[model samples]
Target: MAEALREQQLCLSRFIRDPHSNPAPPGIEARRLAVYRQLFLGNMQSLLAGSFPVLSATLAQTQWQSLTTEFYACHRCKTPLFTEVAGEWVSYLETRSDLPGWVAELAHYEWIETVLLLSDNADPAHDPEGDLLDGVPLLSSLAMPLAYAWPVSHIGPDQLPLEAPVEPTLLLARRGADQKIHFARLAPLAHALLVSLQQQLLTGREHLDALAQRAGVERGALERQGIALLHGLKAQGVVLGTVRG
Candidate 1:
């Protein structure tokens, strides 16, 4: 009985994993299978494309179909649910050998925005400590900040960037206190500073000091910038506590 159940699960997974190829049970003819195959493929493709419109627009139709085909083959999402499929699809693309480095980076650039928008985690709406300038942990509300070595911030329908940007592009993604998603380009030092602070590699002061060194700013200027950043964080509703914690 258990073996039969497992086989059933595998059969359904195969249909979902690559609907264009496999369809229903033994009694179902290839023609009948094609009907289901079309629906399955179209549904999944539209859902992903909706979330990644820029990415979809950039690719040729043939390439888009091929890309989705590859995704159907490579990704084995542990959950049976479809809502989380986008996460697995994005994760799959990051390591896919057949895809070019630039395309992988571009997909990730768009994927993160979706991830932030759907994140289930929620930090408090307000910080009671209220010491915005203290040297405590500096974190994005979700603390899953990411950036890329390419300029994917301006990804649009007009065209894909022909060359990678010499400078790194920072991505600040978080659900704001207003319950809306915000994604913005960040300076390299700012990205490094936030990442360092989140990893506890440095305190807030230490991060600002590093940024100051990199940007060739004076200590006083750095302190002022750090204070400003804290106020920004407070406004975003991610301040957890003071350094005394």
Candidate 2:
């Protein structure tokens, strides 16, 4: 009896996971098996649709359904939580060769908004009045720097570009004290400086010096520009403030 039950379970599982290829378990009505298959796949489709509305809108219905079905059959999600399923779908896209070059990047960009909102990192302890140039700058725990080959922020049904631009798009997404996630377009130098701050490998002054050297500019000029940029970021809650040593 135990062996028969195990066989029946395996048969049902296979049929449900890939109904097109697998036969229903013996004595189970085909109509009942069809309902189970639709229910499981439909629920996953809805979840992914909610998580990636933009991506869904970009792809035709047939293409979208095919992609989701492939994901359901081929990918073994690392996480069991439904909240992380979209992340798993993104990972699956990373391995595919048939997808458009921007598909994976766009999917990831969309997924990041949700990831930041759910982050547990609290506001760091710092001095809001501290000098950005003199003190160690503290990046908000929820701040994320993202670089993309395609203009993912601009991509939609109407704005899809076939070729990537020479300069990549750089963006920063940070959760403000108001609990709102805000996004800003970043210049190259600003992006590099913020990355350095996030690494905590140097003081704001040192980072400015390094950036100045890289840009072949006088240190004083870079310092002035960088300070203003830092102030703007602080106001937006991207930079929490400076950490006192």
Maximum-TM-score candidate? 2
The sequence of per-residue lDDT tens digits that candidate 1 reaches over residues 60-140 is 889988888777666667877776787777787887787656677777777777777777875444345646454455465
Q: In angstroms, what RMSD does candidate 2 have relative to the true structure?
A: 2.0
Worst 10 residues of 2 by lDDT: 195-204
Q: Write the per-residue lDDT of candidate 2 for residues 195-229, one digit (tens) a residue.
A: 88877646789889988998899999889999898
TM per prediction:
0.79, 0.91
Residues forming the 10-long window of minimal summed lDDT in candidate 1:
123-132
Residue 119 C-alpha lDDT in model 2: 88
Please report, in order, the local distance difference test score of every candidate based on alpha carbons: 0.69, 0.87
